[model samples]
Target: MPVAVGPYGQAQPSCFDRVKMGFMMGFAVGMAAGAMFGTFSCLRIGMRGRELMGGVGKTMMQSGGTFGTFMAIGMGIRC
Candidate 1:
């Protein structure tokens, strides 16, 4: 186990542990939330019978790209 000592046993995680944990947690949470919202938004768009690309698709694509870019930037900042 990669443990660090402090007031809290988990106060500091090793560099490798931080990277691994960050990736795992971020991926898991992101996927779950993204999937749920994506599904909900798709269904909502369908119900409206709007041109998806003109209406919701563009927003969705932009949001996805932004999310990815921000995550990449955040990881870089962490190091």
Candidate 2:
């Protein structure tokens, strides 16, 4: 993407850029939370080895995507 010069030689991010930033931030936070909870949940259910890793990964992606979507929407609206 080309630099977007706005007003006085300063580059400005578009609304989509703001939304994408929001999604990335939310995704990072959500992935951390999901990893913590998913690990405990998988362990409590007696999952071991590869099964445990798979469960954790699945949970992480799901939660991250969900949180990212909401954050993007909220940021887009504010923009």
Top-scoring candidate (lDDT): 2
In order, candidate lDDTs are: 0.58, 0.93
Candidate 1: how many backbone clashes? 0
| Candidate 2, superposed: residue stretches over 4 Å from native | 1-9
Q: Tell me how far the alpha carbon of residue 29 in candidate 2 is from the true structure, in angstroms, after superposition.
A: 0.8
Per-model TM-score on C-alpha atoms? 0.43, 0.86
Model 1 alpha-carbon drift over 4 Å, by segment: 1-13, 47-79
TM-score for candidate 1:
0.43
Query: What digit string (tens of lDDT, one per residue) describes model 1 on residues 1-79?
Result: 6455888554675565555555555555555566567657866857455554344455445555556555655665686
Candidate 2 lDDT tens digits, 17-55 = 999999999999889989999999999999999999999
